[model samples]
Target: MRIRAVGTSALMIEVEDPLAWFAALDAARTDGRIDVTDIVPGARTVLLDGVPSVAALTAALRDWPPPAAASVTGDRLDIPVIFDGPDLAQVAAHVGRSPEGVVADLTGTAFRVAFGGFAPGFAYLTGLPWSIPRLESPRPRVPAGSVALAAEYAGIYPTASPGGWQLVGRTDAVLFDIDRTPPALLTPGRTVRFVIA
Candidate 1:
C-alpha cells in the first residue's frame, strides 16, 4: 500500500486490494484512530477526504498492520431480474452453458460492487468466476435497467445510454434517483445478488 497527498486535505491510498483497505480505513474512522469525513473507494485506490493532518495520518497508516482480505462486510441487496436479453445466448455460448444454466450460475454467485463509473449509479461489480468480453461494437443505446457483463464485472444500466457490454438480463429496481439520500444503489463494497423476477 502507498499513500500520496492529494492537495491540502485528503490522502489517496493505492492498494492491491481496495475493498480490504477500505474496510480497514472505515474501521479506523469508526474506532477514532483517524479523523476524516469521507472514505471513497475506487478500483485500486481509497481516497480519504477531510483529513486534519496528512503527515500524522501517513505515519500512523504506515505503522499500522496491512489489512487482511475482506469478506463481504457491507449491506447486501437482492435485485430482481428477468433473465432474458439479446446477448443471453451469446453469453451462454461463450461459457458453454445453456441459457437456463447461465441464469442459474449468475444467480448462484454473489457479486461485489468494485467501483462506480461509466454512468450515474452504474456500478462495476466483481466476483464472476470467468471474465466475459465486451461487445466488439458498442450499442447505440442500452435500455435502462439492462443487466450486462463486461470483462469480470456485472453492471446495470441506470439510464438508457450507449453501451458495449454483453446484455444477459435486466431489472426493474431503481439504480439511481436524485431524490434519494445517497443516489447510487450499488455503492462500492456492497454485496449484491440477482434473483429471478
Candidate 2:
C-alpha cells in the first residue's frame, strides 16, 4: 500500500487490493482509529477526506492491518427483474448460450457490490463467474432500472442515461432516492440477488 497527499486535507491511499483497503479503513473507523469525515473508495484507491494531516493518517495506517473479514455487513437486497431488454438476445448470442440459459446463469449466481461509479447509485457489482463484453456502440439513452452487465461486473441503472453495458433485464427496485437517508440502495459490501419475474 502507498499513501500520498491529496490537496491540503485529504490523503489518497493507493492499494493493490481495493476491497482489502476498504475493509482495513472500515476496521479502523470501527475501532475509533480514523478521524475523517468521509472515505471514498475507488477501484484501486481510497480517498480520506477532512483528515488533519497526511503524516498522521499515514502513521495510523502503518499499524493498521486489513481485516480478515469485511467490516461492513450490509443488508441483503433481492431484486425481481423482467427479462425483456433490447440486448438480451444479443448478449445470449455473444455468450454462446440461449436466452433462457443466460437468464439461468444470471439468476443462479449471487453478486456483491464492489464500488459505485459512472452515475449516482450505480454500483459496479463483482462475483460474476463469467464475463460479458460491452456494446461496440453505446446506446444514446438507457432507461432507469435497467439491469446490465459488462466485463466482470453487473449493474443497475439508477437513472436514465447513456450507457454501453449490455442490458439483460429491468428491475422495479429504486436504486436511488433523494429523500431516503442513504440515497443509494446498493452500497459497497452489500450482497445482491436477482430473481426472475
Candidate 3:
C-alpha cells in the first residue's frame, strides 16, 4: 500500500486489501497532526478529505507500516436483539439450523463497524456467520432500532427507514440522533459486539 497525494481536496491512501486500509485508517486517525474530516475506507483505498495541505498529511502517512490484525482489533458493541424477524424461520431453514441457532449467531459474536455510508448512522459491519439467509425483499417501514442482517453482515437501522436487510430484531439504543454531538454514534473502523438481554 502507498499513501499518495491526490490534490488539495483529499489524500488517497491506496491499499490493496480492504482490511489493510482499515488498519491504516485506524493508525492515521490516532495521530492528531493530520486532521481527517472524511475517512472513506474501501476494499483497497482509504480516502481522506480535508482542507489541510495534502503534502503534510501524505508525508505523515508515508512509511506507516500497517498494523497487525490484533492491532486493528475492532470494538465489541453489545446490541440486544430479538429473534422475531419475519424471515427467522426461513433463515433457519436456509442454514439448516434451528431458529435459535440463527439468533445466537447474530447476537453472540463480535462484529465491527466496517463503514458508515448507506445512510445516516447506518453502520456496515463484517464478520457475520455465513450460514444466514439472504434478504428476499425490503420492508416499507422497519421500525426503529431494528437489527437486520443481509449477505455476510448485520446492522441496526438508525431510523424508521425502508430497508432490505432481513429483519432480525430491535434494540432500544439510539444509533443516530441529531441532538447529540455530530449526531452519528457509529463511525467506520470501530468495533461492535451484540449483547442480547
User: What local distance difference test score does each model get?
Assistant: 0.91, 0.85, 0.72
Q: Comparing 1 and 2 by TM-score, which wins?
A: 2
Q: How far in Å is the alpha carbon of 4 misplaced in model 2?
A: 1.6
After the best TM-score superposition of candidate 3, give how far the Cα of residue 18 lies from its true spot, in angstroms: 4.7
Worst 10 residues of 3 by lDDT: 68-77
Please report how far candidate 1 places residue 186 from its true position, in Å: 1.7
TM-score on alpha carbons, each prediction = 0.91, 0.92, 0.78
Candidate 2 ranges beyond 4 A from true positions? 69-72
Candidate 1, residue 65: lDDT: 77
Q: What TM-score does candidate 1 get on C-alpha atoms? A: 0.91
lDDT of 3 by residue, 34-151 (tens): 6777777754577888737787777766756665552335355566665677777777787788988987777667676666767788887777887455556667788888887788
Worst 10 residues of 1 by lDDT: 66-75
lDDT of 1 by residue, 1-197 (tens): 79999998999999899888888888889999899999988888999999999999989888877789876865799999999999999999999999999999999989999888788899999988678999999999999999999898899999999999999999999999999978999987889999999
Instruction: Report the number of clashing residue pairs per model.
Output: 0, 0, 8
Give candidate 3 misplaced runs (Cα > 4 Å).
2-8, 12-35, 55-63, 70-75, 131-134
Best by lDDT: 1
Model 3 lDDT, residue 25, Cα: 66
Worst lDDT 10-window in candidate 2:
64-73
The model with the greatest TM-score is: 2
